[model samples]
Target chain A: MSELSTAAAVFISIGVAFDLIGGLGLIRLPDIYNRLQAATKCVTLGTCFILIGVLIQFGFTSIGVKAILCLAFILMTSPTAAHAISKGSHDFGIKLWEGSVVDKLAEDKSKE
Target chain B: MMKKMLFHFLMLFGVWLLFTWTLEIPDVIAGVIVSLILAVLLNSIFDGEVTSLLNPVKLFWAIIYIPVFFYHMMVANLDVAYRVLNPGLPIKPGIVKVKTKLKSDLGKTTLANSITLTPGTLTVDIKGEYLYIHWINVLSDNVEEATKEIVDKFEKYIVRFYG
Candidate 1:
C-alpha cells in the first residue's frame, strides 16, 4: 500500500478506537450527564479524525472538500447539541451521579 | 443596510460555492437562490455585520483560534480517555457558576460552545453574565477562580472576534 493510504488507515483505526471508547464510557458512567461527556467528546473527536483521514486520502478533490465541510459541521453542531442535552436533562430533573459534588443550577433555582 | 446585506450575500455565496464545488449553470443558479435566502435570514438574526466575525481582524483571530481549540480538544480527549480507562473512575463531576464579562450574544454563545467543546467541561447554562459549567473535575468552587480557569482560555479570542 502507498504511504498516503497507510496514513489514512492509521487515522481511521484510531478514530474507530475512540468511537469504541466513547461507547464503553456510556455503559461505565453512572449518570446521564457523565454519559454525555463521553459521547460528545470522544465520538466527535473520533469522527473528526476519521474525516481528516478521508481528507488525507482524497486531497483537495471534491470528496475531500466535502469531507472538510462535514468535519466543520460536526465540530460546530455536536458540542452545542450536547450542551442542550445536558441542560435540558438537568432542567427535566435527571439526577446526578451519587458521587457528584455540586449543582449550581439547582442552587440558583432555589435562590430565586 | 443594503450594502451589509450584499456583503453577507457574497460571503454566503462563497461558502455555497465551496460546498457545491461546481460551476455548472444549474448549481450556480441554485446556489444563488439558497445563499440569498440564507444571507437574508442570518442578517435578520444578527441585525448587523454578523457580529464582527466578518471583520478582517476578528477573522484573523478566528483563524488563530481554530488551531488552539484543536489542541485543547486533543488534550481533553486524552484526559477523557484516562478518566474512562482508570480503575478508580476518577471524576469529580459538578456544576460551577463562572462569570464572563462579554456582553455580545455572539461572544457569549461562542464562549459557551467553547467550554462545551473542551474536555472535562461542558457548559450547562448561561444566565446573565454567568455560565454554569459541568466540570468533570471541580478544582475550584469560587466563581472568580473557576471563571479564570474555564473562561480565560477562549474568551479573549471570542471577545475580539465578536466585538
Candidate 2:
C-alpha cells in the first residue's frame, strides 16, 4: 500500500534473486575458482542491494546510516577476502578445469 | 603523511557523525578525539604517503564511476544468471595474466577490486604490473586481448583517481 514498502520489496526480491543465481553458479561451475567467482559476485552485490532497500525503507534515520555503513563495509571487505581466497587456493595447488586454456601464473612461476 | 592522516581523521569523523546523528557537544568531542587517535595510530601503520583522493576532478569522476560500476554489476549478474539457467552451463574459466599501466599500489588495488566486483572475473594475484585473473568466460588467450576485456573500462576511470 505504501511507496517505501513497495520499493523495499522490489529491492529485496532482486537481491534474493541474485543470491539464488549465485548459489546456482556455485553448483554449476566446474571448479573451486569458478565457485568462488559466483559466491563473491552474488553475495556481495545481493547483500548490497538488500542494504540499499533498507536505506530506502529508512531514509536518513539512524538505521539508514547504519545500512550505508554496512554497504560500505561489505564493499571494502568482500573482494579483499575473495582475492585472498582465490590466491590461497591457487597457491595450494588446486588444478584448473581441463578446458582452461591459459595460466600466466604457472608460466611466470616456471620462468622464475 | 600529515595530510593523509588528516584525511583519515576527517573520514572517521564523518562516519562517527553518521553513526551518531545527534548534535550533542559530548558526542562531538568524543568523536573528534577518537577519530584523531585512530587516524594517527592507523596512519603510521603504513610507511609512507596515502593516495590523497582529494582532487575535485577525481571526486567528480568517482561519482560518475558509481553508475558505470553498477551497470557493469548488473550486466555481470545477468550474465551469470543466464549461465546458471542454461543446461549447457557454458563457462571457459582460466587464469590469464594481464598488465596494468597504473603506477601506484592503490591504483593497482582499485583495478583488482573492480575486476573482482564485476562478475565472471576474479583477480587471483598481482605480480609486478601483471594481474592473474580467474575468468569465467575466457574470450581470448592473448594477454593484450584479455586485458582489453578485463581492465580497459575500469583502468580508464581508475587512472584518474589513483594512478
Candidate 3:
C-alpha cells in the first residue's frame, strides 16, 4: 500500500477505537446527561476522523468532496441534536445523577 | 433584492456543482435553471444583507475559527475517552448557568455548539444572555470563572464575525 493509504488506515483505526469507547461510555455512564456527553463528543469526533480518512484516501475526487461535506453536516447537526435532547430531558423533569454537585437551572427556575 | 437573488443563485449553483461534480453543458444548464428558480423562492427567508457573507474580515475570522474549533474538539474527544476508560469514573457532573458576552443569535449559537463539543461541557439550553451547561466536571461554581473557561475561548474568535 502507498504512504497515503497507510495514513488513511491509521486515521480509520483511531476513529474506530474512539467509536467503540463512545459505545462503552453510553452503557457505563450514570445518567442521561453524562451518557449524552460521552456519546455525542466521542462519536462525533470519531465519525469526523473517519470522514477525514476517507477524504485523504479518495483525494480530491467526488467521493472526497462528499466526505468533506458530510463532515461539515455532522459537525453542525450533531451538537444541535444533543443540545435539544438534553434540554428536552431536563424540561421533562428527568433528575440529574445523585452525585451531581450543582443545579443552577433548577435554582434559576425556582427564583422566578 | 437583485443582489440577494444573485447571491442565493450562486450559492445554490455551487452546491449543485459539488453534488454533481460534472461540467457537461447539459448539467450546467439544468443546474442554472434549478438554482435560479429556488433562489427566487428562497431569497425572502434570508435576513440581513447577503453581502455581509462576502466581507473579507468576517471570511478571514471564519477561516481561522475552523482549525481552533477542530483542535478543541480533538482535545475533548481524548479527555472524554480517558474518563470513559478509567476504572473509576471520576466525574462530578452538574448543570450550571454561565453568562455570555455575545448578543447576536449567530454568535450565541456558535458559542453554545463550541462549548458542547469542548472539554467536559455540554450546553443544555440558552436563556437570553445565559447558557445552562451540563459540565462533566464542575471545576468552579462561580459563573464568571466558568464563563471565562468555557465561553471566552470561542467567543474571542466568534465575536469577530458573528457578534
Candidate 4:
C-alpha cells in the first residue's frame, strides 16, 4: 500500500503485459523473422522492467544488485541469441513470408 | 601489456567483489588471485588502449548512452505491442542492408545490437560494413535512408566511446 510498493507493482504489471503481448505475437506473426522482431524487443524490455521493479522494491541489497546484473546480461545476450537464430534460419533457406517487401540478402547472394 | 593485464584484473576483481559482496580479508585475497590468473590469460582479447576505459569523457558519454538506449527500447516495445494487438496486423517485413561508418568491431557489434532492440528492426547478420536487418515495416529500400533511420540515432552516441 506504500508509494514505493505501488510504483513497483505498476512496473511489474507493465512488464507482464509486454510479456503477454510478445507471446501473442509469436503465434500471430506470419513468419520467423517477423516473430523474432516482436518476441525479442518486447520480451527483453518486459523482463528488464520486471527486474527494475525488483530493484526498486529491494533497494541496493544483494538481491537488487543481482537483478541489475541479470538485466545487463539479458540485454547483451538476448539480441545476440535472436540474431544467431535468424541468421541460422535464413542460411538454412527458410523462405520469408510472401508479404515481405524485399530480400536484400538474397539479392546480394544471387549477384555474388 | 602490463596496463591491459591490470585493467582486466581490476574488472574481474570488481565482478568478484559484486558476486561475493563481502570484504573479508580472505575473500579479498581469493578474489585477487583468481582475477590475476584470468587477467593474465585473457588480456589479449582487449585490443583498444586499456587506458581509454578510464577516460572521463568517454565514460560520461557511455553513461549518457544508457538512458538514451533505454528510452528507445521502451518505445520499441510499445510499437511491437501495438502491432501485435492490431486487428489488421499492419506489417511489411523484409531483410534490408544498412551501412555503418563505424569500423571497429566493438562499435559495429554495439550498433547491430542497438538496431535489433529498437523500432521494428532485428539485426540478422553483419557483413563487412553492412548489417542485414529484418525490418517489420519496410519504410525505405534505399541503403542511405535505412541507415539514416536505423543506425544514425545510436551511431552518434556510440562513436564517442567506441570510435
Interface DockQ of each model:
0.77, 0.78, 0.87, 0.84
Q: What is the C-alpha local distance difference test score of each model? A: 0.87, 0.86, 0.90, 0.89
Better of 2 and 3 by lDDT: 3
For residue A34, give model 4's deviation from the true position in Å: 0.9
lDDT at position B61, candidate 2 = 82
lDDT of 1 by residue, A1-112 (tens): 4466888889999899999989989889888888888889999999999999998998898889999989989988998899889889988988788898988888898899
- Top candidate when judged by TM-score against the true structure: 4
lDDT of 1 by residue, B41-160 (tens): 877665663636667888899899989998998999889988998889999999899999899877788788888878699988889988999989899988999998988989887777
lDDT preference between candidates 3 and 4, better one = 3
Docking class of 2: medium
Clashes of 2: 0
iRMSD, per candidate, in listed order: 0.9, 1.2, 0.6, 0.7
Task: Put down candidate 2 lDDT per residue, A1-112, tens digits, no spaces.
Answer: 3466988889988988888888888888888988888888987889999999988898889989999999999998999999999899888998898988788788878898
Candidate 3 docking classification: high
True-vs-predicted CA distance for residue A2, candidate 2, Å: 9.2
List model 2 lDDT by residue over B26-50, tens digit each: 9999999999999988886764334
DockQ of 3: 0.87
Best by lDDT: 3
Q: Say which candidate scores most in DockQ.
A: 3
Candidate 1 colliding pairs = none
The model with the greater lDDT, 1 or 3, is 3
DockQ of 2: 0.78
Q: What TM-score, computed on C-alpha atoms, does each candidate reach?
A: 0.93, 0.94, 0.95, 0.95
